[model samples]
Target: MACCDDTCAPFDGASPAYRRALLAVIAINATMFATEVAAGLGASSRALLADALDFAGDAATYTITLWAIGRPLRTRATAALLKGLSLALMALWVLATTAWQVVVQGMPRAEVMGVIGLLALAANLASVLILVRWKDGDANVRSVWLCSRNDAIGNVAVIAAAGGVWVTARAWPDLVVAAAMAGLFLTSSVKIISQAAAELRAAAAAA
Candidate 1:
């Protein structure tokens, strides 16, 4: 088997370095979630709100990943499936909320979006770097990397939406970005679920 493959041996939570990295990431995500939720509400930015929701989901999943690190393949795969389902739920929530935002139309505060997006970007970038080395592995490990990657991408899009809103003075950019992030979340969820299912089968066969 290839290195870090779940079928043979897994080195996830076994490593002190990996555990430390995850702890730092969990702290970063929790802090960002609180900050962004407040800023998103104050600014009335759908993109920011979507990003904040993502941060909250990430915080929860990262904690799950830490818990499942050294677990059996089946256990880890089940955990990954839970993470994937949670992401799908969050995506649907964002889309529904964004549609409602369209009904009650209003432009967000561009300045606040820009400032908060920048701060979020920095936080996610730090998380990405910290988890870069442990990016590859089983479904449980891969899900953590995917979430971190999505957060960074979402932050960048939020920044772009801020600029677009500033130029056009419309909520379209914010709404569009939120919708796009929802799409990203769904796509990642699919990947995580697929891999986790396959691992589950493999684990059953081995058993």
Candidate 2:
């Protein structure tokens, strides 16, 4: 909105370093997506599934980020909108799955929670390290970085929840973490959608 000044520089998108970082993080997240999905099913853990969907949404976010780099403001806004929609969809999926697990599945398979959660945490931490340098980037790039950062945070929470479940032999902690992750997504979706809407309106006015 401010004519793409220094604040929007990293969003210039064509920078090789930025593209490299995005690709690396995407690869990491995509792999984790599959891993968590499988682990979720094996453990019957709703939190794991929610985290898996988060990873999936991040993969799309990174893809859009890479595409929006150096592109027009309108293009960036469109990408943001798409990512926002993805986040909402993933949140819904998590909510439905978690509710079902709570009502029907009983306690999840404890063994898989700790093992898969630790693996996911390690991978997410690596992703954070890769994207930390660009955290202060433009709105588009910052959005992508935020997704990565949130994922890392969620990963830690999932790991801790797994540990807590193991100690307490209860399913509530896992469900709580999953619900928190849903709440995080809900908030992020609103922010991203609002930004994208503003940008689109501005672009339309200019056109």
Candidate 3:
């Protein structure tokens, strides 16, 4: 089977070093996922939930990358499109959840929002650093990079919201950040999906 063969060397299907790096991202992302979820619930913070879901999305993105690393070009392109779609769904979900909390019920715990946000930002930053070196490796690698980069930007917004919360003692700032994060996800989703679709079409033509 292909899995049994060494042809698909893991981590962007490149050298052992790249495989190691990707593996690290996978492990770290998994841990962060659990951490953020628990913290979000404990804090009852929409911002924390946003971070948690963001990490979840990153985990899914990397999982897709690992699965497509050594596949054919057309397969890789299709995988990227699917990954993008998944991201879009996640964004929609987050937006819906945050909107309900903000407009109907109310904002979540502000203190927890800021604290958990900072913690999640640190974790995501580490993930970004880990994947930065492999950003240009392949479509699979680029997808992972885009996911990480988008997440880092979201984290920054979260951090800023935390500061705003500390000062204003309001939920608007947190809601705003959560909405912005969702927007980023939606934007990235479109770009990745379009690129993947074009690549897949080209591959089919070439075949």
Candidate 4:
């Protein structure tokens, strides 16, 4: 393995603006992670729990990005690869837990799901806006944008699941949404890992 990567069109992740945006995003994700964890436990909402896992993952991702900034290309790619793997692990955990939730068959509180989902959606939307300008970049940079976008999407799904749970009066809706979110996490993980692997390979070749 080489210490450098992406000599071509190497991104600008060291900018003051991007750093500030990343710090703000980190704060938001961390806050949301705590909020959703408490609410999910109180409300028995798997969807909210799944989304909370995402928030935790995003907080870690952004922290890694902050650390990788100004580092070598290989370092950034390695960080992204680690993030991707962690995301995959998180997803698998959610999927397995959601299956067990189905067996337990607890009905989630739809009102809590809807309200918390709305709050999460707003926070993720703000993150997306802050990172939009730098969305198209290297694997490490792109991963941050992808996580924010995924959060917004997950929030919408959580809201819909809340409606479904309310209408059907069943636990299936919450379980289904948690499973779907796991799928989303898997998909994003693949993309990030692929890009990061490519960067690593390119760096090795250049070395």
Candidate 3 residue runs with Cα over 4 Å from true position? 1-13, 128-152
What pairs collide in candidate 2? Answer: 12-70, 13-69, 13-70
Backbone collisions counted per model? 0, 3, 0, 0
**Per-residue CA lDDT of candidate 1, range 6-104, in tens?**
221234545788788878988998999899878877888888878876776667666776787656879888887876777777778778878998999
TM-score of each predicted structure versus truth? 0.79, 0.81, 0.75, 0.79
Summing lDDT over every window of 10 consecutive residues in candidate 4, give the lowest-scoring window.
1-10
Candidate 3 residues 125-165, lDDT tens each?
78767766666547546555555566666667777877887
**Top lDDT: which candidate number?**
4
State each model's CA lDDT, in order.
0.76, 0.73, 0.66, 0.77
Q: Is candidate 3 or candidate 4 better by TM-score?
A: 4
Model 1 CA lDDT for position 27: 98
- Which residue pairs collide in model 4, if any? none
Clashing pairs in 1: none
Measured with C-alpha atoms, the lDDT of residue 121 in candidate 3 is: 68
Error of 2 at 188 (Å): 1.2
Name the runs in model 2 displaced over 4 angstroms.
1-18, 132-150
Arranged by lDDT, best first: 4, 1, 2, 3
Please report, as a residue range, the 10-residue window in candidate 3 with the lowest summed lDDT. 1-10
**Order of models, best TM-score first:** 2, 4, 1, 3
> How does residue 132 of candidate 1 score in lDDT?
68
